[model samples]
Target: MLACLLLAQLLVAFIGRSVGPLGVLIGEDLELSKSQIGMLPAALFLGQAIASIPVGFVVDQTGSKTLLLLISLCVGSSFILMTFSHQFGFVLFLVVIGGLGYGAMHPVTNRGIIHWFQRTQRGFAMGIKQTGITTGSALAGLVLLPLAAMYGWRQVVAAACLLLIMGGVVSYTFYHDSIKETNQDKKNLASFYGSMKHMVRNKPLMLVSISAMGLSGSQLCLVTYIVIYCYEYLDISLFLSGVLLVISEICGSIGRIVWGIISDRLFKGKRVIILMIISGIAGVTSMILAFLPPSTTFGVMIPITMVFGFAISGFNAIWMNVASEVVDTTFSGLSSGFSITLGSLGVITLPPLFGFIVDFFGSFTAGWIMIVGVMILVFMLLLLLLLEIKTRAAY
Candidate 1:
């Protein structure tokens, strides 16, 4: 089941990230400005944000496996349709459709982990599961970009569609819901609006969601622009820049596992405090990245980028786990849905903002500063969350 969930997430992530490394090529082909190119990811995230709450309600009615299967088909079909996109608007439309499919994986898969794993191991399990995101991004960095460079972008999308089809088959064959639904769950499902109302009233979950907005904004800026930053600003080749992205994602994958172990063993399930510490470290690294000397060597930049990736991208599973723990077990999917929807506000807004800063200033420095500032804001919010949790515990 864990493997199935990971595979499901990987497929969705692959579809979502396949365009980032190829951004330059696509922009050249389509004659798009940086801001317009940035809108591609924004449109995708907007679709996901639009779908998350409704999909959460659907997951509560159906199960993760069924939802996974349904979205897998949507993702596969969207990729194939992407092969025919000749205009920017059409591409954006396809990306939004793909994003809608990609949106449900978190709430669905995290809910699965909560059901399938024990409390003692849930952090670690979530950490392992969260690697699906980094893994997918790494694959695109390592494989998709190279292939798209050799063939065309259309061929790359077609090839990705084939893999997504296989992923759909794997999901249908192996994935199963661990939770056995009760009659009471069925009765409660009828009051979906009440559940949404209660979710709005949960202060901790609301704070977590808001914190996610900041962290996600920074993280998206990093991932969406890292390749372009390296290639355009640092005088790196496209292929080497893609390699840097792969390295960052690899570090992010390791960071998730290591951070999860720390939360489980060292912190004894105090996830928010760990998040607070990691967010501080991440904010520091983002500031450092923004200050990298123009003559900096790839070796120096490599380590910084790795640290940034780990610190920025590693804590998501912990956040999801913390959100789940704050609410009733039955509301795990709904709470994560709220977090995802709210968190996606960053995704919907940040990339184009970053691009606009770069285009206006004619350099990446200001954009990088914006990203780091957001990280600092994220750290402050995490601190508040930690204080609130501690105060409630004292009561």
Candidate 2:
């Protein structure tokens, strides 16, 4: 069941990022500027951000299994709709609606995982589950560009619609909810509202949400720009750049699993501490990459990017673990969703802003510096969060 949920999320991520790998071709087809090309992802994040809170609330009220099936259908249908779009505006609209389905996955799927896994096993489980994003994105990076090159980008999207439908079918056929819990959830209509109020008032959850904004923003910039950055800055071939991006995602997939084990065993589930350490690593790596000259070999950059991938990509499941730790079970979905909503601001704004910086400065350096600034902020907040926890513990 967890695997099915993960597969569904992986497919959703593939759909969410469908525009990115093919950005160059899509841009040429639509006659778009760099900033406009960047807006494609921004629009998807925007739609997901808009839907996050409401979907979180819904997840708390209903069964995640049902929501997963429904959202999968929505996502699959949106991809089918996207193939018919002739204008950028229309594509953007479909992406936004598709994003609503994407938004539902985190809250619904994470809650479902939390329901089944014990606390001792959950970090690892969540880690494995979160890999769907990097794995799917990685697969898309490796597969989509070549397909677009051979068959045209529109046809690739049409093919994606079929895969997404399979995800929906798998979710409906195999995924099961806890019937007793679902019945209990229906009995407490007021608890759903109470959960919302609780999440807003919870200081730890709010801090995690704010931390997520920085982490997510920095990570989004990496995912959105790395291919183009390699093409324009390093003069790498588009196909090779896509391969490098795939390597990063594959490394990240491994990191997610490894970090989960470490958090569960070495740290004894001290996820926030792990988050702080990784944030520092991610910050330093971003700064290093930012200042690298065009002459730097891809060999050097590859290992550095692999490290960046390890640091940034590993903590996603940990953040959810941290959120689930702090909140009650009844509000777990709400807390996770709320944090993602706050975090989506980074995804929504950063890509275009990075592109604008690139356009204005005519280089990738300043945009990476922007990411470094966010990482610094993230580190400080995590430090403060840790200190506050210590102070409360001492009291």
Candidate 3:
């Protein structure tokens, strides 16, 4: 089941994250501005944000298997349709369709973990599962850009969508829900309202979710612009810049698994401390990028991108674990959904704003600085959350 869930996530993430690696190609083909290029991913996240909360409710009522299958078909079909798009507006519309499916992924997967894994094991399980995201992005960085360069962006997207569709079929055939729903487990509108009220009133959950807005925004910015920054500003070849993205994603995959182990074994399932550590690492890396010179060597970039990926790209697993655990197991999907909805806000807004800053300033420095400020905000919010957790324990 975990394997199937991971596969499904990987495929969906491939489609969702494809925009980052393909951004330059798409911009060149369509004659798009930086902010317009940024808007492509933002549209996808906007669709995701719109769908997350409602999908969370649906996941609780139904199960993940059906939703997982639907996500594959939805995202795959959307990307396939994008191959027909000649204009930026049409492509954005299709991307939004894909994002709607992307939104359901977390609620379904998080709920699956909550149902199947014990609390002691969930951090690691969630980490292993979340690596599907970075792995998918890595695959995109590794595969799609080269394929697009060789064949064409449209053909590559269409081919990838076909693979995603096949994976969905396999996931549906093998994966079954661990938890069985009974009459008593059924929820109504009143129950949803009650859940919403409870989540809103839950201070720790809210703080963590809000902090995720910054962390998530910063991560998206890194993914969206890092390639462009390397290629355009640092005078790296386009292929080498894509290689940098692949390296970052590979390191991110490693970070997710490593941090999960730390939370489960070393921290004994405490998530916030690890989050604080991630925030600090992310902040420091962003600071470095803000001042990174154009003449910097590829060798120098390697370690910097690796550590940056480890922190910024690696944070979601722990964050999702925290969101799911803070609420009732029954509402794990809803809590994850709510947190993602808030995080999606960051994903939607930050990339375009980061691009706009770069466009206006004619450099990537201010954009990197913006990410540094976001990390600082995340660090403070996590600190407050830690204090709240400690205070509650004291009482």
| Candidate that would win on lDDT | 3
Please provide TM-scores, in order, for all candidate models, with all chains considered together.
0.96, 0.96, 0.98
lDDT per residue for candidate 2 within 1-395, as digits (tens), equals 78888988898888777667777778878898878888887887787788887787777777677887788888778868888888999988988888888888888888887888888899999999999988877888899877887898888977887888788788878888765347653525576667677888888888888999888777777777888888888888888888877887888888888889999999887788889988998989889989988987778778988988888876788988888778878777777888888988988888889889989998889989988898889999998888777776699
Q: Write the per-residue lDDT of candidate 3 for residues 28-49, one digit (tens) a residue.
A: 9999999999998898888889
By TM-score, the best candidate is: 3
lDDT on C-alpha atoms for all candidate structures: 0.82, 0.83, 0.91
Candidate 1 C-alpha lDDT tens digits along 364-392: 88888887788778878878888888888
RMSD of 1: 1.5
Residue ranges of candidate 2 with Cα displaced over 4 Å: 187-192
Error of 1 at 202 (Å): 0.7
Flag clash pairs in model 2.
none
Instruction: Give the Cα error of residue 40 in candidate 1, in Å.
Output: 1.7
Candidate 2 at residue 327, lDDT? Answer: 82
lDDT score at residue 113, model 3, on the 0-100 scale = 86
> In model 1, where do residues sit more than 4 Å from their true spots?
181-184, 187-190
Order of the predicted models by lDDT, top scorer first: 3, 2, 1
